[model samples]
Target: MRFFGIFCIVAILCCDLAAAESPLVVIVHRSRHSPISVEEVARIFLKKQRYWKDGAPVVPINREARSASRRVFEQYFLVRVRSDLVAYWNEQYFHGVFPPATLESDEAVKRYVGADSNAIGYIAADLVDDSVRVVHRLD
Candidate 1:
């Protein structure tokens, strides 16, 4: 019984560490197969590029402001500090452009992106499935 208990604890800790280290993936609906670069993704998230090649409005979904995934996404993709990003959004608000809509969890982001052809969002790589196609990965 003692050996079993210790084994379980070690297994749980290993799982947690693996989950924490999972890469982040940017996803679109499964139907979207076009290649997108990091710069273009940044532009879309910033609301600078508002439409897809087919004239459909590009919808960028962000994880909530307080999420760790959001921090990573902004760091790797936006490449702007929080204060600078805030200032940029402030300027954009004046021009009628706004930051992307935010969802609270990876599951929600996946569902939204899966349902909308023009929508794009990011989630932990481990959560990815058939509902969405990964367009980028931040390793």
Candidate 2:
């Protein structure tokens, strides 16, 4: 019985460690050549920065609020809780600015960013393919 309990604990720890190791990758269309900084990424997601340097409008895509990726992104990048973001968006809506459009899944976000040159989004690192370029990675 003691050995079985120890085995279960080890298995649980390994699963958690695996989850912690999977990174989130920030991605953009392959054609976007300008270097992206983390600060700029935060601004773009917050709807504070509206346009890219070439005059094209910045389109930021977000995963649904309930998604694990969204949680990780908010915790590490946005540094705000969902309720706080909701409040912020409510205020911004009054000013004619809107939050980034949210997709149902990482695949949807990847597809949208892959097709739109002005679009930027983040997804699990393992999901990244040749269709998009990775700008930054968050663990």
Candidate 3:
């Protein structure tokens, strides 16, 4: 019984450690002209930010629509899914609201957002670097 209790406690602690170490990050180009909050970041990711300081389009890149990290990001950041978010965009798209471009891979997103001054993307926090500044980390 004592050994079983100790094993359970250790397992629980490991799980807690993993959960506490969040891996999702909100990344932007090396030149993020504007300081932003998590909410504004969500707005930009949803394609609401139509322009940047240079009057360029705010390009937002995304991971797979159903990725595990994306799901968490959507819930915590965007507060919705691609489908529901699309529905939201549809309402705004008619009003001339443009949406962000979607990318399929971490490397592609990193490369694209890193090279574009008006671009932003998300990736596992471990993948963040000087090329991509981390604006937020999901926990």
Candidate 4:
């Protein structure tokens, strides 16, 4: 019985360690050459930074609210809880600003970012390819 208990604990730890090691990557279309920062990513997602350095309008894509990736992204990148973001966006709505648009899946975000020079989005690091360049990565 003690061996079984120990095995279960080990399995749980391994699962958690795998999840923690899954890397999240921020990507932009390959054509975009400018560097980006976590602070800038936060600004773009919150609709504070409306344009890229080259004078192009910035388009930020977000994952669905309930996605695991979205939860991690919000915690590490935005540094705001869901309730606070709701209240923040409610205030921004009155001022003609809105939160970034959300895509249904990581693949959708990747495709959008890959096609648009002014677009930025985050996805699993393994999904990155030649069509997009990673601007930031969170491990």
In model 2, which residue pairs have backbone atoms overlapping below 3 Å?
A: none
Clashing pairs in 4: none
Which model is ahead, 2 or 3, in terms of TM-score? 2
Q: Tens digits of per-residue lDDT for model 1 on 1-139? A: 9999999879855654454478989999999888999999999999989999889999999987876788888999999999999999999999888789998678889999999999999998999999999999988
lDDT of 4: 0.86
Q: Between the candidate structures 1 and 2, which one is better when assessed by TM-score? A: 1
Each prediction's whole-model lDDT (CA): 0.89, 0.86, 0.73, 0.86
The sequence of per-residue lDDT tens digits that candidate 3 reaches over residues 1-139 is 9999999879855643443365778888887756778878887777666677678877788766545556677889877756798788788788886566677556678888789887888876666778888877775
> Candidate 2's residue-wise lDDT over 57-79, tens digit each?
99999887766677788788888
RMSDs, each prediction? Answer: 5.9, 6.4, 8.3, 6.5
Which has the better TM-score: candidate 2, or candidate 4?
4
- Candidates ranked by TM-score: 1, 4, 2, 3
Which model scores highest in lDDT?
1
Report, for all candidates in order, the number of backbone clashes: 0, 0, 0, 0
Best by TM-score: 1
